[model samples]
Target: MAASGHTGFKRIVKAAGYSWHGLCSTFRHESAFRQELAVSAVLVPLALWLGDDAASRALMIGSVFLVLIVELLNSAVEAAIDRFGGERHQLSARAKDMGSAAVLVSILNAAVIWLLLLI
Candidate 1:
């Protein structure tokens, strides 16, 4: 057998489980994460309902997930920024703001995707 740490599909499953745990930890600790998760729950099912065709379904579902993914990344960045210091700094603030901007862009993307699909 190969010496890779991940033996096979089991490794993928284990990694995914680990990832889920991490996401859960963020959800519990981060208010923004919790909010995003709540939004995703509603949006995902609604997207499924709105998706009358294959392309629409994929677009809606994919866009919702993209927002969630971006939120997670933004939360991670904010955490890292907080860890760097409690003191105020221009660079740190900019970093957090940029991460926030990224998330906002992703949300807009999701909105556009849904709107276009529905049309």
Candidate 2:
């Protein structure tokens, strides 16, 4: 298992801080993340307004959030790949392309979900 230095409240606080740092880093460094966040900002409120029921609302909102989550993970993958391998290699290129593909798929998924919900 991983290390947990603090207990309960302190741990929660530390985690929140870490999360904030991650968000800031992603927003600052990742254009795709920023784009997804902008989409989420628009969709979340629209979901609350458009969804006929709680389940549908959750699905709508969750789909948008899922895109952001996937983008973050994809960004992390790209960052790790870049950090580990500076030289040009097929595997490194493939890894970055795969990460980009994941982000595109997530955006498509969110779009489909929204369309299905609205129509």
- What's the residue-level lDDT of 32 in candidate 2? 80
Q: What clash pairs does model 1 have?
A: none
Off by over 4 Å in 1: 1-14
| Model 2 lDDT per residue over 28-101, tens place | 99998888899789889999999999988998998889889988998888888888767888998898899889
Model 2: how far is 53 from its true place, Å?
1.1
lDDT of 2 at 49: 98
Q: Which sections of candidate 2 miss by over 4 Å?
A: 1-4
Instruction: For residues 10-113, write the lDDT of model 1, one tens digit per residue.
Output: 78888799898988888888887788778889988898888898888888888888888888888888888898779999999998899899989998999999
Model 1, C-alpha of 111: deviation from truth (Å): 0.9
Q: Which candidate number would show the highest TM-score if scored against the true structure?
A: 2
Give me the overall lDDT of model 1. 0.86
